[model samples]
Target: MVLAWNGADPSEVGDGSNYELGVWYRAEVDITITHLRIWTGPGEINVTNRRGRIWSSGGGALAVITLPDNPGDGWTLHALTAPLQIDSGTTFLPSYSTGGNYGALPNALNANVPSADGNLVALSAANSPTGFNGTFNTDPETFPNSGFGAPFYGVDFQYTLGHGDATPPRIVDTSAIADGLQVTAAAVVEDDEDLTGLTLRIDWGDGTDATTVTYPTLQASHTYATSGIYPLLFRATDSSGETANRADFVQVFGADASSNRLNTKAMQQALASHAMVLGNFKTVSLHEPRVRPAEPLHVALWWSTITPIDASGLAVTSARVEWLLRMYTPGEQEPQDEMDAIIGDATDRLIGSLARDFDLDDHVVDGLVRMIDIRGAHGARLNAVAGWARWSDGMSRVVTVTIPVIVNDVWQEGAA
Candidate 1:
């Protein structure tokens, strides 16, 4: 999926301009690029020494391939020596140099191009500081950032759905319970590829041997000798050996104590569903739908991968989770009050000890809670946005969810 435009012939063809012409674009998801393509003009046939290149937004060459000397007068594709992985939400440039006429369509990239696999948006002056269509010296192959008008220079790339099996399996919709001396855990596990050899491991966190099971069977039970609070761990491994881990806190009540005090039944029912998904990697659920002006809001965020994202061997170093809260008058566009927090580095000062690390050691089906001081009038609405960002790249991937909250000094039944 990432293509500059549809496979239609351009309406205009430029005379042999010995310059590199291409499009600057961004992908909505991670993709593995295997080939580069260029729309050749009728006169471009038999042209020799045609070269194509993929460049980073910062002007670094990523991959270069030579087109066939006798490419047909249509879309010409050249496979790279190896597949190149492109991170989601990052910009890149794909260009080709030919001392022959090139096909083009004016103002074609003013908006996103249509693709079946993934979203590909052309960068323009309106949407991007780097602009969209561009040209540069053909011989030296410098980054193409000079053109304008959002023209389609016919440069494109072919990519697969994701970074292959580079991504680990996702563990979502998890539920755990510890009643009396027996503990039970379950999760919905999935991977980018087949789960033929996937395995789920459960550690009761009570100094006992962990329980292991295969895919399609995620539920595990363990019996403890004493009644207490125990940490439960769940780990899933795909065929590629990539693994994802999750944790939960289980409480076992003594004989005289009532298990109903913990409300395990209601918590388990809630864990079966999620309120929303953030950045396609984290699932979120609201724990407290209604809160007072000065009270705190609680939400549970379950990540598909380990916290402090391990984007090693990629473009960035580290990543952090962030959240933003906005309160507004019933139907107003402007916010009356707002609060935000970042849950990685710089967390200590951002929210003043409210930034809690993801409970990888113990997930009590709790929320990442933060106090919100609503200054808006009564009957205000609340919306929450959360996402993750790369520390080095500064590119954020976010998602927004609207959760109803009633902020008032007087408690009223059915008042929204």
Candidate 2:
């Protein structure tokens, strides 16, 4: 729908030709134009020529052409030479200017209502009037002053759709994440003209309603309410009425023993997601040292970045991360009772360290621990132990286990 002016319709026609008059409109969506529907005079008007043109915000002309005159007046559809693409919020002037040979081209005056868009003026004072000599301020075309008063002239101009190169927006792949965690869904969309006019619609496929966004980036995040497979669909449309679609899948899981598997891909994904919570680190390496049956469970996490560890953006440090990994994999022990004491001490030390050195809270630390349990549920459980010697010295160890957590330069922190 176009040209719905709120004010009362005008009783008589206004002047056009000579000094050009056009209506300024802010496009709500990207649009491509082939012609403009301009309402003319109510009485029989003789018109040898009609020009439909557009000007940039700076009073520079972008496109202008002589339109074919249709018999009678009410709405005249003026065809354009080339398709003009108009982006949302881009201000441009669409009007009909007079030619060398002055003809009767009456500008239809709608009711003088305030412009719908703040920018609803008919003429720009910056452009000087032109005369027959093709020069400004010459005879017959004196400069128009005081003509630029407020309550912009009532003019009716609506755009007709033209050919637009509308391509589907490409939805970026989301990283594997655990349930209750936010995952950002991003996309890449472009057009022959400005991309700002493109709108993206995301259907999360979780039985919820779909969402639409304009000029969207890959930063929109959604947290799955439960663990399951979600089909992702994205549809992108441009102002010119062109559209495209793409589909993808997202797998979400919760922290459960049944969810943990000895799969290499799953292990890598889980570890990467966990390490990412440490904020922006330079390098990350997850290693599960071969564990003896009764020996202390050990997993090594090594990460570094070019930036200082204490930098404002880099919140996690090597010391803090070491303490976290220990909590997750503290290995099994011979006597379960004795093992509990060692685990208790380790937990206390973690809290003490935070209280004394790092000003962090128990609740925050507990949240991190929960993330580890859920993200690494499929991996071997690490039992907390004081030392290898604490294990029964005479017992023979039956099995060895290993888990690797690796992160490279591509690591990024998830939404807090």
Candidate 3:
């Protein structure tokens, strides 16, 4: 089933106003509408006149149904006798009559509502400043021409793809096995329809072209010359072009793990086994101990909260957590370069909170990786200070950890 609006129910309900209320929407691809739905308030009565309707851009009624009385406080679906086929990019309105109390969320339709299957309820002001979430003040059902405050009136529809495929391919599981410098990746994929033409593509995330394979042969291998952590992306596209994607990570260890050098796993294990708790969070750093000058120094830092750390007071809805990694010369007081990121802020692109990303129990470790350039440096004496800070005051809420950075002396052989 496909729906134009997938958000939670509206928080507010209005009085029993006899108005025709609905939203205007379009689909990315051709779709067939099979049912219309409305939100009925609890203990709502007099539902005999409750009607569901679909109107074209020209105010022509395409489909109409008399909704059955439902006193429940949730969505109620009403099937249409004949499925209505809507062309792509065609704008239409799906509405219901508010014979009794109705549910609405003001300013909810300010942005477009897009379903995973490609149907979209455009912004309330897309057509005109007063056009999308329409309302007509009349007892009889009619095409609503005026809108108010971009409110969502709890009207939606169920649809299916015109191509007859109602479901997309699913990537059930993914795995990556690293053997030395080579990593083998595989996935288990299934589709509701036939999998005759299913295609699987793997992006090694090392700036290489993705590897594609057909169904029943969903495995691929890649070899890297350097040791680092690589993210593996798997995407499966079915015959109908419906796709599903999954991601995993592969850590490659270099052939040499000498005293001066440590592998990715070794560094991670060393940091994890140690009791390194900074304030309310624990951190682990993984990187090669030695790197060549001008080469990208890949570092992955894992952190989780040891306790409930709230940067903002209880009065604020949310707070920000900042992560900083600074590189400095040994015995120096200043950093040569640094990287910082802020989370839990309104401007954050990442979706989640400190509690969501890092469980207080610290069972799950969330990590961030960065590549720092060490150009013009030839000595084996460098330091990296990593820690977290409070975004409000720019102060370190967590104790910082200093790791050694050793640049190999290969670049100094021909330099004077």
Quick one: best TM-score, which candidate? Answer: 3
Best by lDDT: 3
Candidate 1 residue lDDT tens string, 1-416: 23444534565375756778767777787777767877776677676777789988888899998888767777755767787888989888888886767777777767666554446566654565474454455553666667657677778776656776345788886777766778788988876544555789987766899999987788988888765556556789865467987755565656644331222232222221221112111222323223222212223333121123332234322222222322211121123223233222122222221222212113223321111222212222233345433334233222333322111111222434
- Model 3 TM: 0.39
lDDT scores for all predictions? 0.54, 0.41, 0.56
Worst 10 residues of 2 by lDDT: 131-140
Error of 1 at 397 (Å): 54
Between which residue pairs do clashes occur in model 3?
none
Query: Residue 328 CA error for candidate 2 (Å)?
Result: 48
As for model 3, its CA RMSD to the true structure in angstroms is: 21.1
- Predicted candidate 2 versus true structure: per-residue lDDT over 43-156, tens digit per residue: 424555655666665657677776655434444444456667777556555555433322222232222232354333232222223201111111212222223322233234
Query: Model 3 residue 264 lDDT?
Result: 36
**Candidate order, TM-score descending:** 3, 1, 2
lDDT of 1: 0.54
